[model samples]
Target: MAESATALAIMGMALVTYLTRVGGLFLAGRLPTGRRWRAALTAMPGVILVSLVAPLVLGAGVAEAMGAMVVLALARRVALPVVVVAGIVVVAVGRAWLTG
Candidate 1:
């Protein structure tokens, strides 16, 4: 594609993303803050995370699988940064061990 086309595409994507976020916030503010709604909203992040990660995990190699497992274990008991670091370390080590 031409440079101008690429730039236009990027701008379009950014606009779409910005609009989606703004629309979500706007709708959320208008939604009922009942217990069920609040619980669902609170769980939305985890649901989204799993939806994103599930495909990668299912298609992953042993090293990636090990890393995902490490992340899962740490996720329940530790902060996100720690879980991320541990997952990276586990994947790297597992890959090295497998290759060596």
Candidate 2:
């Protein structure tokens, strides 16, 4: 009985969390976040991209990550696809070199 009760409690908490995340999708259309919020939302992608990539470049503290960043910087003046390929190549080489 105690085990079942604990399981039920955990299940309930998981359900609540799932609902909260999904609920936002439904409720978002109704919310009037206004012009400022809309403008901020437009900028969110770049913000999120930086948020994700910045940590990888700075916090990863690995040779591959540093090499990738350098390649990425060079690619900026050249082309985006070039930068992406450079990153992949750098990572693959670094991993193989470091591991083997």
Cα RMSD of all models vs. native, in order, equals 3.6, 4.8
**TM-score result, candidate 2:** 0.52
* lDDT (10s digit) by residue, model 2, range 9-67: 99999999999989978986787789998988789889999998777777775765757
lDDT of 2 at 1: 83
Give the Å shift of residue 45 in candidate 2: 2.9
lDDT of 2: 0.80
* Candidate 2 Cα outliers beyond 4 Å, as residue runs: 1-13, 70-89, 92-100
Taken over the whole model, the C-alpha lDDT of each candidate is 0.90, 0.80
TM-score of 1: 0.62
* Error at 11, model 2, angstroms: 2.3
Q: Which prediction has the highest TM-score against the true structure?
A: 1
